[model samples]
Target chain A: MLLIEMFVFLGTIAFAISGSLLAIQKRLDIFGVLLLGLTTALAGGVIRDLMIGNIPPTNLAEPQYFLVSLLASLSTIIFFERIKKFNHSIAFFDAIGLGVFTAVGANAVLSFEYSQPFLIITMGLVTGIGGGVLRDVFVQEIPQVFRKEVYGMASIAGSVALIISYDFVSPIISLYICLTVTFTIRMLALKWKW
Target chain B: MLLIEMFVFLGTIAFAISGSLLAIQKRLDIFGVLLLGLTTALAGGVIRDLMIGNIPPTNLAEPQYFLVSLLASLSTIIFFERIKKFNHSIAFFDAIGLGVFTAVGANAVLSFEYSQPFLIITMGLVTGIGGGVLRDVFVQEIPQVFRKEVYGMASIAGSVALIISYDFVSPIISLYICLTVTFTIRMLALKWKW
Candidate 1:
């Protein structure tokens, strides 16, 4: 398996766990929680693929991705109390998921050979925030991206950093740069009054 | 305005009203109801557009859609009792909204030059059911589309009919044929044992 593919798989698992935890917090039924997790894990990438005219959708094409999401959901369910007690851990993990997914989304768009400036930025934002948007909407809340958290700005920063470093940096370096930019922006947003 | 544009506008209004009515039924707060109504009215098309890479999002580009949604939401809040007494009427209106939006969405994609195939069919289904999916997810109900109802199938049939007729008939004729197919399928699904 390619390195990038593995990263995407990790991102999917983290995203799914984030969603599962959110649903569990809401006291949703087990089935509902799983559905939420699966949807959050796959929905952003699926929508991105469909929009860019990628056929078959990534989730349907990859069983491993689905398995990861399922396992994450199950784990959350099995460890609800333990997970609940580690709230900061969950938040940091979710942030990492968001950062990695943002970078991966930007990479996917660039790989597709789409160079439109706004389109690339938008892809990064959508990919990073789409799952959370769906999660909030499912829970009947305003999407987190729309609020003034600088959350989506992390996605923008990551995408821009990836694009700028494309010429000089190695792929691994680019990934870290993107992740660092996103993680720092997100953490700072949470730390400082934004 | 172009005839199709007018229909799209009308469809938005109709969907907005239906969303507002559902919110009222749920006894949500006024802000919550309006939020539900506006999001439901706009979400499907927004998702469709984003998937197709239509940027800036139509809802964002046109303020009137928001205005119409607001008016519809406010009207429902003011006239809840009257609307409640006419549940059947509201359902019929909602059906019309569905029919109109399905046709509009199919036509828009066809105009974008996507050829007939599974993609076009999927687009129609997305457009038809997107808002309702958002609505159900918010209400925490199992989505009507996934259930045994013929909801998405109706839109798929309508889209296919539209595509088939576009080669031989004027746009208006195609619209009529599409609407007829969609409305018939939906109403039958509601009225009959199937």
Candidate 2:
């Protein structure tokens, strides 16, 4: 459980870093860049929370997300050239982030007893892809989800796998299986240009 | 009713134009600009609809909103400099657009029989301010809602007026009153530098 929480938090932090770096690359002012990172990292979860009738948004309730993203942004700016050169590495971590996000989101919704499988799947996908969609929109680029790449598809696949495996395997085992499947597919897609 | 719908369309078109023009100003590709405008104009309504369990969203069901926004964006691009010169006038129109969006959003939620008045007012504010938020976020700017010109405050005021006036006036009159009140306040705010 602690490991799961750690990976989830790391996934969130990674997404935040990715978003903040995108902002910095665009030459946005510090406030603008931080806002971009904050919103990009939190928008998906915020939207999900709002849809599930959680008001005022979790980002406001827990301010650590914003603080962490700001720190990440500052660090990226300090190491700009090195960070830019590590694009593939970032994408690989992004894949892990996506897997973790989808798992957490699906598990969250299920814990709330949202019964519709379709809704669960949709939530999983939204939670996984929402941040990046927001980041792309902020960067004034067409979202990758709408273009090509199996970005959200990996998350959905992972989510479905988690749900199916939850009944048959231990929760930890199911999580590992889902993450492995998502990471493999996503990495392969990037490697072979699938 | 047709006239009311016409105003609703006008607000959507105006916001869409603003979004598209921003995208173009930022030198985004055409598809990117259009997607930004579409999402900017409709993200609030889409989120609202999805929250209320309306899948696929109203904008998807009826393409008129998207079409109007597309045309508006194209028109703005064609007349960029001319429009830019009329910044104040455009701001006035933008305020009106915000008012109309607030009214329509409140009407939609009230129609759904949501019992919480505060929630309805909050929804109205979200609907009105959501487009601009999306626009700013896409442009990688801090959302005006978080800081600046009392945007969401105006929407909240308008929603309160609308809900209160519903008891004393015809629904149409109530909408007109709300819109007028919101637009007037916004215009004054702009003029007085409030």
Candidate 1 CAPRI level: incorrect
A-chain TM-score, model 2 = 0.90
Instruction: Give candidate 2's error at residue A136 in angstroms.
Output: 5.8
Q: Over the stretch B77-172, how does candidate 1's per-residue lDDT look in tens digits?
A: 898888779877766766776777788777766667765444465566667778878887776765555453466667878988987998899978
Error of model 1, residue B169, in angstroms: 1.6
**DockQ score of candidate 2?**
0.08
Tens-digit per-residue lDDT, A50-140, candidate 2: 5554566676688776677667667766777898899998888788878877776666666666645555665676677788887887678
Name the Cα RMSD for model 1.
Answer: 7.8
lDDT of 1 at A21: 87
